[model samples]
Target: MFKNVLSENIWGRVVSEKEPVFEEINKIVESNSKLISKLNNEYHDHDSTIKLLSEITGQKVDDSVGVNLPLYSDFGKHLSIGKSVFINSNVMFTDLGGITLEDHVLIGPRVNLLSVNHPTNPEQRRGLIVSPITIKKNAWIGAAATVLPGVTIGENAIVGANAVVTKDVPANTVVTGSPAKVVKTI
Candidate 1:
């Protein structure tokens, strides 16, 4: 059985949950988890929390980026945030592949951006696939929305509350419901 799965864009390399690469990724997760714990528990300084997030993610998060506390992520290094982004509380980012939020993006409370998934085949169920999720500039994701792997929300698009986004959303569109269908174009 083929244990290695080829990821399209996340890493552009062969990946397998059973391989050493997954182990390394797990270590990153573990370390970041501790830092995120501190970030959630200690809430005196917002700047310090952002600094810790930047350190864990290895990205220069702009000062203008406002992320409310109690955010969670499986891997922080794979996340990249653009300028003037507002992420509300209780957001979960599973960025094993990558999750990019462009400038002026607004993510509402309890939103989930996930980028890692397993294959359907039980024999290869342990195999993991990583895909990048991109929310373009000025997009707004409503409260409790879940953006799945490889999804790209286009510029100025709006995902309605509690929507489960499984595919790419067009630019200047409003999407709602499970699987996220475009209801109107802005």
Candidate 2:
């Protein structure tokens, strides 16, 4: 069950009365631009901040957590991660649905770690669908990859670049192509 913050929920809602709520949501993200940009400055000293974020997520990022990118989060729920994980640039996650990345995971650039999936029902889809996403330890998701909702990326799996993973990827396997399929077992 997800209890999204009011402003964060607006992105999932579109109603006349809720328009202001959505606007406020945008404002919160907008006002954080300076902080966001500064956060993206790879040259800045961010060990403390990154560690803080990892702590907030209930994840262990080990001693090497360095990268300059816009880290987005909602719900402020605890995200669990393992050690020696590398998260690259242009990574966007709506944790209103919760996201967990495990140890030794290598996430390439522009990887969209989505937690929400649209419902099959048209009306429900139009409203909103929320679910969590988990990437187990040693999972290497390639660049420009899009991982769908509620899917568990198994440990020691390799998801190829530009792949759209709509289902679970088995551990110790390599997968590519849209709606990724297993290429071979590692």
Candidate 3:
């Protein structure tokens, strides 16, 4: 079903909602949403949750990774969680383009890692723009932070609580507030 519609290089691609390809994408999203709902509601233990996450990603999730319940992802297949990563409860990942959480990353509660967005132009608002989001190794994202599409959180960086990141964060820095600005360097 996802022949030309989805691929490894889907980043920066635009797909209109009117297109047939979008229907195929929506179908996958719907099916994955059901599994995500089950993961949120039924699986409370660590092993069971990781097992379901592995099923969602179509790969074996490492035993070293830890994730709390109520995790959400619109396109679960595009998410990559590395070893020693700890994800808190109620985190959301819109990983259509792809979202990579590198090893030893720490994600606080209610964080949103968005890798897909709609066009800014009103005429093209119905279309979706694919962009990848990468959280480098050992990075820490505070509670309720929202990382926008195409942004990369650098290694060992810290994102403050409720920060809205719209651009790439430099390594070993601390960023806070909307459109997140660097406040300190570690």
Candidate 4:
């Protein structure tokens, strides 16, 4: 269903909303949204939730993963969750550009992992910029943090609560504040 525009090379490209490809993408997003609603509202048990999530992503989600619902994703097909990953409630993943959470990753409540943005130029603001976001193994993203497009949180790193991460975080470090900076290295 998503063959027209779901390519690895889609990263960093700006796609106009008026394009036919955008319509195709929108359809997929809408369909996924319905499934997400079921995940948030209908399914309460862990097994049932994971089964629905697997259907949403078009992949087999591992049973080792745990997600507290009310989880949201704009484009579900691009999200990849590894074994033993735990995602808290109220988390939003705008994963159109792709998002991968490696094994042992912990996502706290209300966190936003956004891999899609718009052009800064007002005239081209309707055009979408696609980028990937990766959370490496053992990384813990604290409550209410926002990880922006193209950012990677390295293995064993900790993102402090409410931080806005705009750049890559190195491994074994603790980062805090807006445009999150490494405050300590482990």
What are the TM-scores, per candidate, against the unseen true structure? 0.92, 0.71, 0.93, 0.95
Candidate 2 per-residue lDDT, tens place, 1-186, comes to 233445444334323323465465455445444445545554545676576554444344556655446565543342455567787877766564557777678889888888755556655544445566789888999998988877889989999999999999888999999989999999
Q: Write the per-residue lDDT of candidate 3 for residues 1-186, one digit (tens) a residue.
A: 011235334456677788776777788798898999899878468888889998887667889999877889998887888999999989999988788889999999999999889989899898889888899999999999999999999999999999999999999999999989999999
| Candidate 4: tens digits of C-alpha lDDT, residues 19-86 | 77787788989999899888887847988998998988887889999998889999898888889999
RMSD of each: 4.7, 4.8, 2.8, 2.4
lDDT of 1 by residue, 30-134 (tens): 888998898888864768877987876787788898988888987888888888999999999998778889999999999999988877778878777778899
- Most lDDT-accurate candidate: 4
The collision pairs in model 4 are none
Q: Model 3 segments beyond 4 Å from truth?
A: 1-9
Query: Distance from true position, residue 63, model 4, in Å?
Result: 0.3
Local lDDT at 91 for model 3? 96
| Evaluation by TM-score, superior candidate among 3 and 4 | 4
- Candidate 3 lDDT at 146 equals 99
